[model samples]
Target: MNHEISNQLKQNQDIRENLKFLAENFSGKIVFSTSFGIEDQVITDVIFSQKLSAVEVFTLDTGRLFQETYATWDKTQIQYGQKISAYYPNNKKIEGFINENGINPFYESVNLRKQCCHIRKVEPLQRALKDVKIWITGLRAEHSPNRNELEILQWDEQYELYKYNPLLHWTTEEVKDYVTKKGVPYNVLHDQGFVSIGCAPCTRALKEGEDFRAGRWWWEDTSKKECGLHS
Candidate 1:
């Protein structure tokens, strides 16, 4: 991490205050990527309700998202009166991929799934993050075992930017409590056991005691489930 960002991380303040500090100092250079999940909604509430003008908010619309996700997206806009930019996959690439492979090739193999994610997510994410300095996320340690090693603020060499996970230490219950108290717009699928929501085809409701990320790409090995956007 940069020494300046490290210093800011050492402040030990609440998420809202820390986010305010980052927004003030890194004005026009900060960006938040959301997927309309509960944790993302909490951060969206903080950014919009606090009027964090320095932050740019965007989402990758993979064209395979659930109808509920779109509804939550609209509700979020209505609540905050702010537009969250939507980034789409390149039409040419998508067409080529679908023509080369089947429309649902991801179910064939892990490599195919990763290829789908790369086209629909990673590529668009790169475009969304172009020239960004600080990338804020809704990542929580408990979301996945892989996320446990992540720091609250860390350097992302792939994007060449500082990544901030303001909700890094927050539990699932804490996220829900905060969202309820703040009246943050969230996806209703959460109440139906969809612990972590993603593109519709790749996600499903989890059974009891399953990991939060288990609902996403459940057919793959646990160690190989990331969509490459965060990795």
Candidate 2:
């Protein structure tokens, strides 16, 4: 972490104040990626409702997202009147992979699944972060044990930029309360058992007492399930 900037961020009284500081100082170099989850919706509300245009907001469309996710996307744009940018995987690469290994080979093995994630989410994210200095994500430590090791603001050597997890310390209850009070639009799947939603085929609503990430890649071993987007 850059202690100077990190200290400056800590000086802010709240997330909005910190975001405003960044907007005023690092305008045009910051970006936020959302998936319409409760946590992401909170960030979107602040960035859009507050009209913090300095931070570029976007999503990675894996082309396999649930219809409910799409509906939430539309409602968010309509309510906020801000067009969230979209990034898709490279056509040639996806098409070539599909032709060579069938459309859903990711179901066959972990290696295949990772390849799919790299092509669909990671690659597009790489393109999205090009020339970007700060990458914002609605990551909370409670989401997974892996995230428990991350700081709210830190340098990501993988992306060659600073990563900001504004809601890192926030609990699930706090995030839900923020969304409801702010009237931020969110995915309906959350009303069911879906604590974490992603691609349609890859994600499922959690059963009882399951880990946050179990909703995604439920077929894989419980060791660590990441899409390569976050580290």
Candidate 3:
């Protein structure tokens, strides 16, 4: 491990204290990406409640988000009194793709789906991570089988930054409890069994015994569910 990661682990600090340490000590810019899910809301609360400076919080507006997601986004800003920057897809690229294929071409094949995701999510994420040295996220280990192998702090070569997952070890129940106790703003779809929220067309509510990630890209193979944002 790097000295900073080692030090932070040694300290055994809480989320806010560790984030404060990163805000003060990390050399380059620090940024957090939120989708306004319950996990992200908890981290947002930590950042805003502690008043951490030098930390930029932003979200990717895929243009296909649910109304509830937008409402939660507004509520988060109002509750924290912080401006969360919004990154959007390249309109030209989206228009070209849609014209060539169709609006919902993602439902046809994996390649088309990945293409839409690249234009809508992965590309915007690249723009968001530009010039950032430390990228904070609300990823939890329990969210997916792939995520279970991720460390709390790891290098993301695609983004060329250190990805920090503050809630890596946290469970869904724990996240919900924290959000409720802290009164953090979250999407109402979560209450309707939406374990993971993403673009409107690709997401749905999970049934009993379903994995947390089952709600996202339910039509795709389990191995190909992610939108390449975290991959």
> What are the C-alpha RMSDs, in order, of all predicted structures?
1.3, 1.2, 1.5
The lDDT per prediction is: 0.90, 0.90, 0.89
Tens digits of per-residue lDDT, candidate 1, 1-231, equal 467767777566588888898898888889999999999999899899999978999999999999999999999999889999999999999999999999899998989899999999999999998888899999998888888899888889999999998898988889999988988889999999898899999999999888777888888875647899877
What TM-score do all the candidates reach, one by one?
0.96, 0.97, 0.96
Per-residue alpha-carbon lDDT of candidate 3 for residues 189-224, written as tens digits (9 for 90 to 100): 998989889999999999999888888889887564
Model 2 residue 88 CA deviation (Å) reads: 0.4
lDDT of 1 at 185: 83
Model 3 lDDT-worst window of ten: 4-13
Total backbone collisions, model 1: 0
Clashes of 2: 0
Worst 10 residues of 1 by lDDT: 4-13
Candidate 2, residues 153-187, lDDT tens digits: the string is 88899999998888999999999899888788889
Per-residue lDDT value at 21 in model 1: 87
